[model samples]
Target: MAKLIALNKPFGVICQFSGDNNTLSDYVDIPNIYPAGRLDKDSEGLVILTDDGKLQNLISNPKYNKTKTYVVQVEGEISDDVASSLQKGVQLKDGNTKPARVKIIEEPSWLWVRTPPIRIRKNIPTSWIEISISEGKNRQIRRMTASVGFPTLRLIRTKIDKWHLGDITSGSYVTL
Candidate 1:
């Protein structure tokens, strides 16, 4: 039988199973499972792990076009122009990103406080936005927000295709 696990990765935890830094093994004890995709140490939210290679590729490969949604807390309030630019596609050093689904959103009510909370600039207000993209480029969400003049203060992946973080607390996992 194939096993799929959805994990709510916490901030400061590395993606891999083995490393000097805190890693998946510290949170997940399953054997023979691998992450379908990766999230940066500074980022939080859903990470899918599975023992099936084909399923991993299906979720992680850009060619499969699995949409991933992120809730971003940015340094400055998101503007109409910034949201438009993200929806129209932002040019990055790697290349032009595919157009994304962008919308200004309120901070998630279920959000947990980071252990080391994000820096607060009393003069600069922060706002949240939701962005959905199909590509899994490294630091893509952070890069995209930065390009739009709103550097991301924190990022959390909320959903991937049909799966979602839902009520899962940080560092918790659900087997499917």
Candidate 2:
């Protein structure tokens, strides 16, 4: 069986195990295990790691169409029209994205404080939205929201297919 680990990777940490600073090695010390998929250095939340190569490929490969769910805080009050656009597919520079499930939501009560925090503009309003997509384009969620006019201010991946971030705390991991 694969040794699977679910980690709540904090923001600013790189995905790889080796780097100059703030890399996975700092949090995960188990040798030979690798991240199943990647999150941006600036994006915080769940990152799955396993020693099984096939399992890693299954989670990261776009062809598998494993769903990834994110809670996003975007600039401005999000609208039904924006949600609908995301659900129908949005035109991106890379090409049109697959339709995503999107809905405006109140800030997640389970959310924790981000390190250094997101910028706040007192004049511009912000809103929270949940988005679930099966495709992982490079920075897809951010690009999708920006394409529809509400730029994402903060992003947190909460789920990846059957595995979830759950209650994993920042910079911590739990073996499964």
TM-score of 1: 0.98
lDDT of 2 by residue, 22-77 (tens): 99999999999999889999899989999999999999999999999999999998
Candidate 1 pairs with clashing backbones: none
Lowest lDDT 10-residue stretch of candidate 2: 107-116
Instruction: Give the Å shift of residue 40 in candidate 1.
Output: 0.9
Kindly list the per-residue Cα lDDT of model 1 for residues 112-169, writing each as its tens digit: 9898999998999999999999997899999999998999999999999999999999
lDDT for residue 78 in candidate 2, whole number 0-100 = 90
Q: Which lDDT values do the candidates have, in the order given?
A: 0.94, 0.94
What TM-score quantifies how close candidate 2 is to the native fold? 0.98
- Model 2 pairs in collision: none
